[model samples]
Target: MTTSKKRKREIDDTQRVSFALSDQPVTQLGPVLAHFPSIKPTKSTSFKCYKTQTQKPMIDNEDMPFAEIPMLVAGETEAVDFYSSEETRRGSLGSRYFVGVHNKRTGITTLRAAPLHILTHEVKALKGLQPAAVSTLQRLEARAALGETFGTKKAKLAIRAQERNKVDISAMEGVADHLQESILKNTSTLPSKEEAKASADSTRLIPQYDIDALNSSDIYPLHNMIPKPEWKALSISAYMSAGGGAERVALLPFKRSNWINDHLAIAFASPSPNKTAIKMLIYISTMIAFHKATFKDINKEVIQQKLPMVPSVVIDGLLSRFTETARGSIEARRTPEKGTMLLTHMFALCLHVDDFATDTSVLAADLSMEPAKVNMLFKTLGCKVNKLTQSDLKRLGLPDSAGEVKRAILKTPLEFPKPRTRRRA
Candidate 1:
């Protein structure tokens, strides 16, 4: 007599888990469930699970909520990047609305960010559109520290959450910019309605400043160029000076810095940096006027000529903190206001010099220097010029062909020594 055996109900099919596509282990086990049969899981709308996942205080399966997963439809990339899991399962949603994801087994929630039907990483939009929590070790450490009790130092960081979800009107322009950038970034065949609308609205929000208005002396005409208060604050920090003192003189008027420390370190104070940046900008405009370089109206030739002048100010400002150029122009890429000013100068220069080109042989004539001297100057400034072809010349804005050239060419050929007199000819 043999007893019939019953296998307890086994979870034979794959259950969703809160894992990113790149690291999800679901695919590796696909072969086990192959050929058995696949019954698609309904989105389970109007169900307890969906409501529980989206609950404010979090429910039992909070860990695997629709909001916590990353996309992982292994072969389907379209489904991965642009579509949401909810949209694919139940179909498209209305404007400014989306249904996220949740894992039944683990009870965690995550955002459904798949493009079409492919799987990708899921993220939770922290309430109020604050920074998507960066799960960095440094951040984790700081967060943990916040929970700890403090002693005499009494460290406290009060974070005030918004009362309501208000569209930041002032940041509408920035949001519009972000939306436009998002559209440009998306290279898919068909964009979602939300994406299209965002792109359109962003285009409308970012006001275009007229080039003529920017050139004009009148401010009212160029009112369109107004940026946010933050931008205004940044403009003040166009340059920065160092703080703290170096012996004898606590804060000297920037002596050339040595290896010990820099000449002027940027102060992070808003509106303006410490004395260094203020003095630096004043110094630059003053010096340029002192040298008296030809300017055919700054507003007209705003982009090219003046822009190039910016790197000088950036270089000088950095030097004010230190004696020597450190890390080359790496530091210049940062320092926001100085960077913007430099860009303006570049724009101005482009405006002034139409069809302006440079050639080593030609540069010698303008500077009244030998070819060797010109080469030396260019090389010291980290420029590379080609011996043949015209790549380097093009960078100098020089023409490719001699006949079709627009700008004047100035060259200093190597001088030839006279041959010994043939019996005093």
Candidate 2:
């Protein structure tokens, strides 16, 4: 303790392996590296790690002598990979010349394009022309500068004729139309143009015939009217019988003779021909012809006239049936004062007689009918028979006292009556 004693060096035994005393610890400890007896290490033999690849079939450099490699220029060398990394940029060009003509009257603007040379020349010539013309030229310049490709110079102007107010062969009506015409005319006159046109004319894919000339005469000569082929085909049909058939069956012969005998032979040849109907038709025809000859025309009074043999009621019934069947007349708007009359006949009468006047009462008196009937007839016929309002009269350039305005024209035909239901008892 008295002598200067140095503390034993503190060993860091944390790195050393720890041991635990166990029943079999002795057996496990015998296998440790320290338990093995040390032996002298042997020296490594001097052998190649990898055999050197036998001097790669020695190339004769003397014979090869670096086959003259082309020397790329300084700039060329840089350019090779220089562009490789960068994206190539390009621009698309559009129409070159722009010649727009504005029609002040029609308000239509025509736009056209010309070659660059033609457009430049046009602009130079357009110096002192109309402001519109000058502006159009300027537009062409601007378009060309913007890298637009002008189509062919369609509008050709004479530059030298700018000084003379006289005939500049360029001036024409409808500038755009003239431009197109000029282009067509110039192109058509080129070499081989006539030959090409002749070839085209000879090889027309669709044959064309003059429609008027073709329709002038019947191509086939069956009937004077119908083509021979059509008449022949129809006559040979199974439906056409010698005794009786549809009118289409007799069409071929009917055209030749439409006399009473022809009608009797063809139309009345049906098996169940009604004798009574035939008599009635004969009577009506005789009455109609007699009235036409005597009174010049048949009216309601003429129709009501009784024949010597037939009863008045029979005549009335026949007339009613005839009016309905022949004229397609409707009996509507019947009043006690004015009995039912054929509306179609009344409409024709009114159209012929009435002056688009508001005086419906006067019209009724003249037509020998009630005012209400007159109003209904005019209304059904789509005529504006009512009095015009004050505003309307003024707009029509008529005095307020213009009680009688013109009769309104019929705009549309009368509509048929709707189906009526029977009253339940």
Which candidate comes out best when scored by TM-score?
A: 2
Best by lDDT: 2
Off by over 4 Å in 2: 1-344, 352-358, 389-400, 404-409, 412-425
- Per-prediction CA RMSD (Å): 28.9, 38.3
- Cα lDDT tens digits, model 1, 194-248, are 7775464334311232322332222112122222331233233323333333431
Global lDDT for candidate 1?
0.33
- How high is the CA lDDT of each candidate model? 0.33, 0.35
- Segments in model 1 whose C-alpha atoms lie over 4 Å from true places: 1-351, 356-362, 368-425
Q: In candidate 2, what are the lDDT values of residues 1-425, reduced to their tens digit? A: 49767888776544343332223321121110111022211233111111122345744433321211111111112112111111101111343333355555554555433212100012234346844233344454565544324433432233223324444433553575557668778997876956765554434221121222332111111132222342233212222334553343333321222222333353356676544333322332333332232232335454444333233444454344333323464442223222223332233333322222334564455344677766665554335665666765664455777645434343223222233579999
Question: TM-score for every candidate vs. truth?
Answer: 0.15, 0.18
| Model 1 TM-score, 2 decimals | 0.15
> Total backbone clashes of model 2?
9
Question: Distance (Å) between predicted and true CA of 73, model 1?
Answer: 14
